[model samples]
Target: MPVAIRSGVAEPVWFVLTAIVFLVLLRRGQRRATPAAVLVTGAIVVAGSLLLPFVLPPVADDPGTGGPGIDGAVNPLINLGDDLRQGGDVPALTYTTSSTQGVYLRLATLDKFDGRQWEPADIDPARTHDVAKFPAPTGLTSAVKRRTLKASVQVDDISGRWLPVPYPASRITGVDDDWKWVAGGLTVRSRSTSASGQHYTASFLDLKPDLAQLRAATPSPVGMPLDVSVPTGMPAIIAQTALRVTANATTEYDKAVALQDYFQSDGGFTYSETAPVDQHYDGSGADIIAQFLQKKAGYCVHFSSAMAIMARTLGIPARVVVGFQPGTPASVNDKRVFQVSSHDLHAWPELYFAGIGWLRFEPTPGRGVLPTYSDPQAVDDAINQGGGTASPGATASAGPSSSASDPGGASAAPSASAGAATATDRADATPWIVLIVLLVAIALLFTPAAIRAAQRARRMRAVARGRDPAGNAWAELRDTARDNGWAAPDTQTPREFAERLTVTLASSAARIDGLRRGVETTAYARAPGPIRVEDLRSVVKAIGASTSGRDRVRAVLLPPSLVARVRGDEE
Candidate 1:
């Protein structure tokens, strides 16, 4: 998940809390080196930082309500339907294309279905640095009229580590060296740089398959191995719906076209940002599809996930694509550019047909461009049956509810004024935002122990710098024993402690006496004796060797002395 930086007074609040924790820790360390105050104060800082975003209300650069799974990856992005529904008209990214048609740059292709949501499968580790002349499309050939286009993209505040690139990109320029080509999805991703602030130009070839050619294409069994696996426990309604909808269609392409028409047209489903009340499938995967089937109302995530799952259920290899829709057109330097906003963030289903390879479908209502090859008769039938036009932006309220007055309507023109997230939009992002906070809290809980270990290491290093390294090493070992529930009383003299060690740990008696003699010589003599490193290790090893296996393990893992010091509950 991307860390959203919203402009608010939360920054000042964060600084104040951090300062308080540091000051409290410093004061406590000076007194008794207790970590209780530090731990409590640090926990507060972590929790407060997480909650402040929600409490302060979203400001500029606010990442609108995240749907489910959207990252910066070029493949395997999932759970974006909810974000599509919940987002306000925030800017996502902008692009300038050589062609008149809007270009849909893909983020990731999610193929793995874990019953709850769709995710990307493991990709080949072999990465290509060069983006010039990628592997050719599997089945596309010279017969198809391939349109070559150059597109320059500029990312705004979008988060995630993946770079967005069009399918079958031939060349890319101006990308950082960290970017790598992932073969399975044919998308580019960065090893470090995020999608935000990315500026690059991509050269891609778009093969527009004719409706007839797609319809005639057969299903290849080999290609089906990628994304055609459907979970066994998938709702029966999904399979039944796919069967029922495509019953009249004969070819694989037509079956796909039929499913598209069923969802976008004849199905009477409306485009809305909110999920239906009676249907509770807000999460992803098979269960969400079941709820989507019954409700028939959701944003793009629901529609895309459902269609992809349905295609797989019908034995067609399908995957969901997460990316920005070709945004609204704008003129810059007399060239046309598409301004994709956060609201333009979308997900759609793509199905693979043999010979034609993978082709995209627009099942998401009022959200994406309709594919060029949808069956004309079926599309008209859908329109006649109260299904709207194939336009991505249908005329509906700009919020959560849907409007059926104009389905299959023309794409809604992007508004010039659409910018910052509203109060309502900020409110929608609250739950997921809180989840991020809780994760931070879990990480912060171990802060005190980590700090104490670091301090002990520093102290040990400082002690080693003195003339009596052996004596200091002995003292460290004694403290270690004390922390791990062994006896290391301050009242015992060095010789007395050595005698006690000989009795308690019989095997280490000679080494313990040697260490004690060194300590006594360093303390009593004006000129300290030279230190031997092995004397300290010899005694420490003997002590460890004498303890039971369970006690030795406990001493290393659960340092009772450190815990007692932190709690100011020394025993």
Candidate 2:
């Protein structure tokens, strides 16, 4: 086929755009001054533009690998690798008997991209098969002492459904691809989640792909693909880099052998997470490839990406595979079985040669165990390849958790804590939370002055008509007092108010100061500015109470706004 080569730079652009939607939908948007009718309409638009994707698959960056497995179109964010790396919970490292299995934390699988978005299962299979295969590094090593390692996986907080397994999984069974092994079906794929959680066993077989045997087995092309559009300048540099690695090799197998040796050598293994911010941040994919090859020290993604580009320079078709390694035993089960956690996630490369679909090659510093099949049942199934029936683990991750029980399991249902809140609800409420805060702020800004002006106008009217202006003001204050759970004394002086407050708390010197200020502002300087409001608020109702007192304690006790804290504090 036409070599469908790609670079890492193209993938992140799509992911960044996908993650931004979560942040944008959080705000109510520019509807502050608008009326309810217009605001509601705008909210709907924003909801569709942002929140809708939470329900639908992200069509932009993904190429259809399968029918959007239950994990749906946004598998990258749900998988432990991308999900945990970005932020949030540090993924649990131990996979116990109760952890999830049969979860495929898919990396990047593109079936079709129709201009603007990914169509995850709609790409016709005919277009996927490449006719012209490129050359890749694979050699024969005649050691036949096969070693086997067993690894299992578990899932806890992760959602969208898919099985999790490292790449090159040779035989998977006892769980549910619902049991089809597609030769290259080594990558994990699952469509369901379990309720009680899951566990599964995977066997990794170590093989020495003998160079002499492989070379004699068939004449093939290197798996690295190419495009005519490589930035012309970087192509030459990429070629030089490739030549440096394989110059001593005379045979294609030897060339492949040299490339592998270069990667495994000590000078080859440096974990690289840092990139030249401004330069690598640019869209020059070729430049990124050349830089990575020159540095010789990057993570698996960088290594695979650089390898692909350099291979293309030598006319090979290659691609990067982001999956997991056959995991280490997570925990011993009740049956004393060992389980694996999510941390085993890994990435590597797949080089395609003629006739041989795609063989796995890990250029990363350490070696990862690839799965092997020893079961007679497994061999029979392999001889008779079924549908997508080849799956992993018997226990599926039921649906995502809808409840997190306290240790006692006796806590009340969450309804926004009376005072502070649980971290989960706080994070979940981000969009609405920001909007509520903004609205409250706007109301406070204008509402305080508006109510005062109306009061002054009423008082002036009362005086002109011969009503008691002072009485009117006191009446307004009394009405507010009743609503606020305060009882203004029918006839009391400033001294009387202070004495009554002192009786409640004889040692409250600080609060007494605030009360004194309120009394002066009310009984002496009062008026047009609502200065005396503070004093009346203190005497008639509870104001400026110590934080340790009733007010601060109440918010956490009542929770939702309707549940009053200090009698009238709910409003």
Candidate 3:
């Protein structure tokens, strides 16, 4: 079987595999005394390990029903993102929901972005108490007419520490005592019990709010605010894309729906596990989100991560859910059981709206059904006006909900009678404005380097044109030496500088002598001769070779002479 490097085990396994390869190479190197063998072996080892995870042998060719055997050391929760992104065709879990329509079973929510990765703000296993009910879905009440969904899940081959459950799970029964409620993502987790072979029933509330009602709901500015601040150094394309996609959207709800439509429908994003397109974002994380948007192809992780980040860029609190989608249905003794395989492992984005709570949206195509309320033509204007019966899925039965809702709801949607319009507009503009400011700040960061490079180029051109070329070349050499920590003053004569260089760059004495003679003739001889470009090049190359790699790099990048000259010009 091709080694399908499990996400959690990839690092340690790579280390061990590499060490073994090294030891074998070391033994051979000692016996043969051929250093070339070691270098070739090292390259092979690196290439092999990197390509190992992606290799799919005949056995792996069909990852049907279950994943590779699980070792207790791997926590599937943390590795879920990688697993789903890898697009393995293994079994994850199986479940039977009372409703025929498939629902997304969430495992966890990631919140923080440190430019490169998205991780949960905190995971304190101690915070989970053995509670029967979570405080009722934040905004759900008798008024919302919530419907309850019951699901029975059995782990097949996947072994993860976290139990997958639908959002706002009201209760869970029939599981080991180890399961605890985690609040960050409103998920149930257990470190002691792997999800494999475990069975449990979860009851979650399905809140069905009409599109107009959702569009009208104003997210609170305080108390678990949905407005997430974008981190610094994030790619500017994220915010720019978010704004451009939702430019005509008048409400946060509309902007979110617009984004979903763009990704899932009109956006022309292709669904692929291997990122059929090499340029597509292949489930990396926050930093790669911009690339994901541009490439428009990837598996669930790419779709979910991109949508969530875009939502955040629009100042909406959004999160990516790592979970399994409702899978193929099978009949077991008259009971409709959904057989969720590892192949069904999926992710989607959820955006929080005040009054309505966290609403899920399906941005990945070919994975799950899009909610009906998201469809504009299906939305009844009378329903949004609170006159018609609840929207198609509002009754909360276990069936695929229709995405029928006001398509242009945001366009004609009325704002709250008070100061809502101004506040909403400001909220919508904050992300773009912040992005603009950040872009300006980033350009300023490289301003000094850019100025130094220009100054160096200008002076080099002047010297090449024979404007006291030998003297200028000598001056350039002295400045380079000074920048690299050698003390050379303008007051020194050409011969004196050459002597100093002879001591420092002992191997390049001849080159330095030639440069000194040229400078001396140009500066002092009654009849000055043009300096040879070949001689100047040789002396510069010799000086560079004499310096350490670190100093040479710094001299080229932040040449002190050019920087000083630029500063002098500024002064």
Candidate 4:
């Protein structure tokens, strides 16, 4: 069976068989069974289950061990091929924005490269702030053309401590107070809360700096030394390749563009998810990148890490960003939404320039949108035709030679207008949009099941905390019954509902009877003893297992309990 179908079916089958065996044994020993015998059997089962971890070998491909997970947590410098190989388009998030430019929902930035892999810089207590508002972006100057854009994000399936937001966010709302803003990269994260059920809106700046501005801007290493530091044992080929690629370029920006072009267009690199694994160079360490430079075939992690390390060798401050690219555009409830899935997981490089801060460059071919400002061919044409510079007021909408006052600008100067034409062509040549559209429907179809699973986990956590365990467990039972096509009407007493469930599910009557007594005791008694959450979960699992396979599928997909909530019914 496929992983998707197996994951949904395996647990229920196991639990149902276990329950049947237990019931049959109990019935066979009814005349001779004692409380101590039952307790001893349960203890043996629990002890054996606890020892399985030590008996079994570790799974090398587990998430958080060496690769990015379906959740937003990533170890970018290690390996990112595992999740990419999962081979499913699971939805991660959805957002709505009016901005025409593509969006990159950033999760974390890797600034320090240890001998092994790249990691974030150590957290500074003074630099961390509450997530309600963030400090201004580092090194951003007023000379750069930018506009404020707002996006509303709703997390669907991804869960982790890292909060995904647009880069350089100015203000954020709707997240919990525990989420903290790390000022170094303007990234949000939490120590106490998971970013699973969050719905937040972010106000961020959309920076648009023309090629001339980037060329004139000098590289500044004032407060960032780690970004440019290379380990002593790094392969010499990294620096050699960086210098060779940008040898023809004169300025810092041109050098950056040259390196980007080398990887994206000129280097003859191929994007393959399995190549690095097959070739035994899957990580983003110095040796792995040197191998990638030779192999010329790998995924975004290899490409991005290679570019960032290469830029650092050339005295440029650079870092790698792990995040999702702008997703497929779709309409939901008559509103436009961009749906991002696990398949859109990507990594890219950010090169720091003076007066413009850290500008993103896409060096991974066939992966993401290449920013118009980072177009090497366009910058070369503008520099050759014009005086190799634009006025300080030049905007992204105008060409590099827009400042030239020629009455015959449209006809006489074809080379001067080439930069603008190339930008236009890049905008129209988005192939990812069409490919992702075919996947949007599948993601949206499974969204209800994901939401129901989250709700169940939340309720289970509450029960484990001993916060009204009886009431929460009872509510979950009712919802489960309703989802499996059984009804417990509002008018029925707890005892009557339990009796009906006992007959409908053909489960052990004692389990349903015990749950009914617990609910009655919590609701009616002045003081009630605690109800064990494990017992409650066992009863619920047994009931769920009793349903047919088709019923289980429908229950997961359409979940009538959620519909009943919207319709103002208590089922």
Candidate 5:
């Protein structure tokens, strides 16, 4: 480790990672022409972006009504959803006093699957559900003032073989196997093994000749292999863009430097959770590149893609690097918190310099050197700032519920309001404004009779499972059908529930039957437990698959008005 950073240039791991990332992107590009493939890709990205995080305790960065106030004091990042799991009821959710708790807001931990997807980190039958450990002491490294910046890390997972931490990890911690640090700024295992986020501490030693001095020196003749070619359609754009951005730079390093600057300039780049994905269809990698340029938006993947494509266009080989960014050093007693957010998700390009293995270029905005905690003052902001409501489109929860006429009964039913944006106040007099909208809403509103009459049709479903015939379940089932444009009979029996399922939603019949049967079985068998999770899974899936299921998904995903026609049938 000491010998590696003698020259403040990048380590060789930079090129290897770039090559691997490029290969993955190129393969994806090869099949981009197919719509089906592109859609699948988009779907995967979306699902991964959404579903996976929730199954486990929600990751801090996982989207909800989160922001820099209210729950900010609790630092949800400290515990795996302790605040949300406790439903904001836990005292931990409140922080009257400023407590810099030593909790690790896990910057990134993929227990399931490899580098991508919701695949379980491993299918180890004997694997513990939860482990009683932290990054092993050896795994943890420290950047002691002098002797050495000991960075320790542990790889506790077994699904994927990829390492943790982002590029430019100047020094490593906790890597104590036969493995040694590589020039690419990472440690490598001879074979793939899911490793833990080893705990190690290290400091960016003040090597005499820093970046400038090293860049001035010639790069060593380390063999750089083109493990992966640029995805198709990428080459042309890469060349053109590179020429436009770096034509002035006489040397490769100079060109790389200018491109880095442009990204930070008027590129409009950002670390957004709202980036688009081609989950289902396969678009040419070139098309993906084109979309990026036109849209000029996305997560790290996009930024890295654009940079590499542009660099290659100018005849300079470049690759993207994916790793955790440098974390701010913090010492905690109870738990070492490493809070990572959607903001922490980043991507950057590594341009190959003749003598400098690969220099890092942060194409993604809000990246590079950042704080360990997401704006420590955010807690104080929430504290000093009294209660306010949050309205839609407000950054996370700007405040509280502000007014009535919350569009579509959005706030009609009081929710917990933990993350409500600064909503329009109830008395924020919008007399004429409310009057006009109310008139419009009234013109489109249904009478109370209509609401009751509709509810009466899906008469109380009394499953034998000791469920109340006319309870929340009944209402829920009825609403589910109505949402799908299916109006169940008032006397819906288990058989009836199953029979009413339209062929379009035939797949969902099993679910209705399962729930009905389970309730019956519980009541008849006098079972002590409720529907097991496994059984509930299919029931939920069925309800989700039915016509009503489609409606529910649409209503939640898209605005209610967009699906007004479909909903009208339910009424």
Candidate 6:
């Protein structure tokens, strides 16, 4: 047999041995020994099979070890699919920062697009520098205002060769690995170490360029030659769409903003993690972008890649950055923390300007924050209303609707006022909706108990009216026992059932015996004496009290007797 078949052959051999043992025992006039002999044979076979792996020599190429490795090259589009398909929110890392703005911890950059998929750029030795100290950010001039912010990060469950750091980091300390920095992007990575158990502090420059500065900036390829270049034989729709979307824009910043708006808001695009996969274009390839533009529905990978590729077509330096978005806020050890999870894995585009270097642009709808400066409409509205240009410290808003709802350059004040009112209405109604849902759930949870209580009450009323008191009491006693998980079979007589209950309900044995006698006399005797309804009630109570606490609660909340009666399992 081939190794594949041989490895799984134990089960068939064990079945054959068990069958042979049963036949041998039966033929030798030992019919009673067949079951035991077969069982013994199966046990021995299973025990022996457990040793087969240890006895057999190992195979050279084990298929189990061939998965994505830490620090190994991975396709960002495929990684996004895997992350979205995950069933649970698994924590990847956590960080604490004083800044109120959301933090984007970039892990890697995919600048190389080969018409099939996007990959990390080839690491040039000259551009890669030691991580002991970082050089000044590339192409960042004094015109763009920036402030230093410190964040303490703790890695929890993620494993990768690339370290998650805030972009444009000035310095990082407390990492045990010998990490290195790629100068142009300022991304950190290690050649051998994994980011499995790391606690590090990073000091990064939080660049906040005003709208005026970005508009005046020009697209420069002085150092980032690769970021600006699009591969040959690429899809024509990429460039064509870019030209059409930004046809009204003049500057590089305006063109970049237009591209972001097209994908994020204006293009009729909706975010769906599974749409691209179902449509057979789930990749960051040139062809994938062309299809994505037509379909107009995909997750962050499609949105970011389309924007990045479109920007490159317009002679702007662009790349796709893979990392985590700002995570949910939590508290640990009485300290505030932002916990990032596998579900937070995201991809966004970075477009470069001459003086501003690489500026982050959010082209994915409903995922990350849309920077205030990137929203040209918001900036223009502020200036028109005598508020001046948006402040550098102004907080960015989230979602595609963060900017103007009207793309034709209309005043957004009326729409903003209406939206605020609708939001307030929803906020006020939320608690009432929750309360109604909770009340309905509680009612449904105790429906069985309520029905059972009503049935008992009806039976007590009938007994009080002298309508077969002994028969009603007997039925109630049996139901009470069944609800507490002490059921009596149909074959058992009332006397036999009462005798069995005498052991557990020793203190109430006399009451149980009297009830059983009353039921027998009522069924058999033609002129039976009247039985007191009080004696029947006392007997049912005794049986209920004899049960354990857990059984008592279960009987009240979800009695098994009701279910059994509904299924016609009880008389």
Residue range 1-571, candidate 2, lDDT tens digits: 0001211112322433433454346434543322222333333443333334334543422322233122222223222223213433333223322222222222333221111111122111222222121111123122422233344545433333334442333344355423222112233333333311334554433332323333443323444232212235554666786788888866544454456556656245555434422234211145444565666655444454455445445544444444333333333444433322334344444444443334444455543421112111332342233211121221112211101101110010100000011111222344564355345434433443345446545754663454543444444444333333344455765456556556755665445455455435555664522333333334333422423454433322222222222123422
Could you estimate the TM-score for every candidate?
0.56, 0.40, 0.55, 0.55, 0.36, 0.55
422-522 in candidate 3: lDDT tens per residue? 12223334345435534543444444456655654565776778777775677667776766767777677878878988887777787778777877787
Q: Which segments of model 2 are wrong by more than 4 Å?
A: 1-153, 156-158, 166-171, 176-198, 201-208, 217-235, 264-269, 275-285, 329-342, 353-357, 366-571
Q: Tens digits of per-residue lDDT for model 4 on 357-384? A: 8877767776766555565445445334
Candidate 6 clash total?
A: 0
TM-score of 5: 0.36
Model 1 local distance difference test score = 0.60
**Rank order (by lDDT, best first):** 6, 4, 1, 3, 2, 5
Predicted structure 2: lDDT:
0.35
Query: Cα lDDT for residue 549, model 3?
Result: 80
The predictions' CA RMSDs to the true structure, in order, are 16.0, 18.3, 15.1, 22.2, 25.2, 19.4
How good is model 4 by TM-score? Answer: 0.55
- What is candidate 4's CA lDDT for residue 554? 72
lDDT of 5 by residue, 477-543 (tens): 5555554456565566645665565355565555556556655664567553243334344443465
Top TM-score prediction, candidate number:
1
lDDT at position 127, candidate 4:
31
Give model 3's TM-score versus the native structure. Answer: 0.55
Candidate 3 wrong stretches, greater than 4 Å:
1-88, 139-142, 225-227, 376-571
- The deviation in Å at residue 309 for candidate 4 is 0.5
Q: Model 5: C-alpha RMSD to truth?
A: 25.2
- The Cα local distance difference test for each model comes to 0.60, 0.35, 0.58, 0.64, 0.35, 0.65
- lDDT for model 5 comes to 0.35
- Scored by lDDT, model 4 comes in at 0.64
List pairs with backbone clashes in candidate 6. none
Compute the lDDT of residue 2 as modeled in candidate 4.
24
